[model samples]
Target: MTWRPAGVMGVAPSLVVALADHLQKLGAVERVRDPADRRRQILTLTEHGRELLGVCAELARSADAEFAADLTEAESAVLTALLDRLTGR
Candidate 1:
């Protein structure tokens, strides 16, 4: 659905489903049917998924640091502030 973050990321529903299945195979997530709607499946992160999230966070932080390395401290702060405003953060 367009309401999903995956949609914002430009991922097709079929790709999302495939990825969810792969995550299930890796014990990183599980899919459960919605009790109210049998056709709808919800993907919930497992403990492994939480660990993966931690790693993803670290990588994102490192990338951010690297990307901002050329900017002065004040410039970095201003850029961050502007980006936050644009992103409605």
Candidate 2:
């Protein structure tokens, strides 16, 4: 999703700005003025950022599988459903 400064929620605006700055410095993202509106800027992920996110997703999946290794399939399925409910997904 394209994120504008005002779109950030549940965090301090200053923290969001700082994180945005850090991401930009890491070449993870860029902010560009909206073509139709000079007063607004849109944040876009860079190719490197997309790659990093893919790696992160893979690692998360690995960790999740490992965490459930000791559980029976039914238990894991129940846990997954519980987590999905808690996460509002």
What tens digits encode model 1's per-residue C-alpha lDDT throughout 1-89?
32574666677878877888898998899889989789888889999999998999999999999999999999999999999998872
Model 1: pairs clashing at backbone N, Cα or C within 3 Å: none
Residue pair clashes in candidate 2? none
Backbone N/Cα/C clashes per model: 0, 0
Q: Give Cα distance to truth, residue 72, candidate 2, Å.
A: 0.9
Q: Which residues of candidate 1, in runs, are more than 4 Å off?
A: 1-10
lDDT of 2 by residue, 1-89 (tens): 55655444657777887988898998999999899889766789999889988999999999999999999999999998999997773
Error of 1 at 68 (Å): 1.0
> Candidate 2: global Cα-lDDT?
0.85
Q: Each model's TM-score?
A: 0.75, 0.76
Cα RMSD, model 2: 3.0
